[model samples]
Target: MGTKPKTRFGVIFEGAKRELFSVRELDNGDLSIFFKAPPFYDFLDGRSEKTLEHRYSFHRSLNSTPPAITLMRTVALEGGQIIRTSQLRWRAGESFSTMVFARACPTLRPEHYIMKERPKDTVILLYPIDIGRTTLFYHVVVTDTSLDPVIFRRSGLWVTSETFGHFKLVVLSGFFLILPFHRGFVSHAMTSKMRVDGQEIGADLPPIDLGNVSPERLLIDIGRMTTLLAEGLAERHISYIREQRYAERFVTETRQLLSLRPVPTPPDLPRR
Candidate 1:
């Protein structure tokens, strides 16, 4: 009998190299196109109420331009065969529109959560690219409300050994979430650093400099009771042991201090 190979999540970035060139070309083209248009004006004829809104429509257009890269998903089998499975495309010039939608209103549903959809948004265009034997596609999806939760909580932490630039962490807090994004580059090595409540702690590091003392020292300074509270939230067995040890040490020290009484000189036995 053969054993099944383990599968893991991975991200493959497309057209990353050509990103700068594509953006520059798109910006120049948009600028030239808008420069030919005349300025807007308002009229007070009373027949119609039209006002001039000269608000850099061209700049918005340029900012909304999509990247030339394409994104896709792949699956690999145990025997070392790679299979291209899913096609994930990027939407062009939909950034601003989506931002507007999210700012306006937001909603959450189980089914629509995974797939990106915008209720009050429109699509601009779809661009296709050829990656060797694979054909990739990019579509612009826009919305007036936030599309979806950036982080997948069930998956926990997503780590990669590639480059630090490609790493991303999406933290969800309350009704809003934050997505911290970075780009991958071949010239630099990937580094991972972690800090708990502004204090740096954890193994596997290029040693994140949190500008504060080490986590152990911080906990010690805060006292044993507070340290235990933090350890409870961490929910890690190792952390519990660490807290216990710290408490034990603290108790021992306190007892030692209490036991030490001022040594009596015995008054030199009344000068003997």
Candidate 2:
């Protein structure tokens, strides 16, 4: 029997105005693109300093915010064919200036077809749209699943702030996980005795807590870690807090600590 053949696809991008733009694929199968539009500072009509400060703080707190762009778009290709549903869109308002944002080529693994032994010819064209219109252009080529060549292309003008706040959360969570682990070498080992239908099937192994810690302390630490993890997951629409067993334990422990009652100290008694 013969093996099935792979498909191919094509794509193209055209900017309404000449601007900076780039595209990259994330680890989680999401495609991301970043671009900048003309500076819109002049359009800040009667904008208060407080409002500006708030905007700046929000952007700063979330390091994943991309620079302002007049317009941005991303398209995904599988086996050389563009997947329409995977298209992403963004656009900024008309107030920003025309300085093009810096273009970036973050590390991305192009789909396997792009790296095939006999890769198909692909072209990406980018240029200015017009003098008054600050637009960028893109052209991509791909091969379809039926081994037919097809083109996927689109163009648009820049729009307002397009922030990747959710991506930032993922990065923050990763940083948190690494920080404590880097501070000291801590190891957690778990042993579970298996039983069939409630019958004892094995002897209990000795408990070994690699880190010098008590149950209360361990639970507290775990709770804090889970809190951060939960925050990150929630930002990414991952309901691990409710679905994962460990995450549930962390939530329970954290709530317990927050609601803990005061413990009374025993009175000293004189001995005869």
Residue lDDT tens for model 1, 34-61: 1100122212354322222111111222
Model 2 lDDT-worst window of ten: 50-59
* Stretches of candidate 1 exceeding 4 Å from the true structure: 1-69, 92-272
- Report every candidate's CA lDDT: 0.22, 0.23
Give the TM-score comparing model 1 with the true structure, all chains together: 0.15
Clashing residue pairs found in predicted model 1: 64-93, 91-139, 91-140, 101-144, 101-145, 102-145, 102-146, 164-190, 165-182, 165-183
Q: Which one wins on TM-score?
A: 2
